[model samples]
Target: MHDYTIRAFVQGNAEFVGFDKYAEVFGSTTFPTALLNTAVFTLVSILFQYAAGLALAVFFRSGFRLSGVLRAMFLVPWLLPLIVSASTWAWMLSSENGIVNSVLGAFGVPQINWLTSPDTALLSVIVANIWLGIPFNLVILYSGLQNIPGELAEAASLDGAGAWKQFWSITFPLLRPVSAITLLLGLIYTLKVVDVIWVMTTGGPGNSTTTLAIWSYREAFGTGQPDFSPAAAVGNVLILIALVFGFLHLQLQHRQEGS
Candidate 1:
């Protein structure tokens, strides 16, 4: 990145000159748009995924008939290959004849241009990612709940506290450490996600879905002027963000262990 394509140009691979990659990256009209899309996509997806995962964790933590089978079933989305998930979602979100639009039409709602419209393309990918991430969050949070002393919940119930109160007053508080780790890992993973977005929209509909990872990828791999320097610069920026969050996760884990 520091050399700014000088070596690549020397090797007759690139045509760009000067250390203008960074400037070009930041100055581009799509840069801020991509940043905004990334922030909104990651935050909204993680928020919904954590909530759904925690709810699923609580639901199946207790003994119930067929619970084991059903819990395993819920993980199918997470266990599927990234390419499979991406392709499946792409078809489901297709603007022409997707199942999603059909369902919406059946409910008297207008069919959505899910993957075609810039306004909804980012949202479409975010929904797919949330579905992909929930099972992972479920397993982690469920394990944390299992490790919590059951006596505390029993004691709260004995004190006449209802289920909701017991969860808020006892269970949820004790699940804090695990929740922090889940969210940190979610943020890091979501920041670098490329396959889903690439397959679904290719960061398209006029760059409405372009994110840091997608931007880096297109710069390095997309045809017509492949430049490694700018891609490296963008990728380095993405890695820096992930590393900061990873460092925080380690610190949080250390403090939890120390206490």
Candidate 2:
């Protein structure tokens, strides 16, 4: 990673002329691609994580044999430092000597170049992120499930409501508030994620995994001449993205509260 002391003023012909780093950042080819990648990575990771977590929550709604023990075990991923998880996943997804490939080989599947290839690098990181995020979903949704009055399910059962009917008419409706909170928080957290992508791919393989967060980091820190102005511009764009999600989250929250 490149590092440089902050310069209060930019000095170059651009200063004398009419060159604008702000315009350059937006008009550049890189920004659009990074934005697109960030959106895809965040949406896909959160969607799958929520699905998997909610499933786990529902499964563990009622305490079972060793359920607490197992739930604690599930928390391992979320408890781990992002750096550790990212590094571990990097090792696991390595093309040749990776555990994932080895397991697939055992099943006679072809070895997939997970991190090295442009096509699969983003996907590999998303899968790791989903794993990292699932425990948060499970814990929050499980608490939400517990807060739900048991009588609701009892009444539904007495009314001969099937499992599906109970979930849709009862469980899912109640989960909406918690679900909204989870997704919004997930969005905020996922939007600025830089560690995993950086550690795994360094936004390489021809920039296939260069999300906005990574883009911002690279602009400020990766290049030889660290241009803080364009990097600041990119940071503002990230803030705008966050604001959009923040608005949606507030809307969801207000509607939930009003209901």
lDDT against the true structure, each candidate: 0.89, 0.88
* TM-score of each model, paired residue for residue: 0.94, 0.90
Best by lDDT: 1
Estimate, for each residue in 93-181, the C-alpha lDDT of model 1 and write its tens digit.
88768999988888998878998898899889999999999999999999999999999999999999999999999999999999999
TM-score of decoy 1: 0.94
Candidate 2 lDDT over residue span 120-173, tens digit each = 999999999999999999999999999899999999999999888999999999
For model 1, where is the 10-residue window of minimal lDDT? 1-10
- CA shift of 81, model 1, Å: 0.7
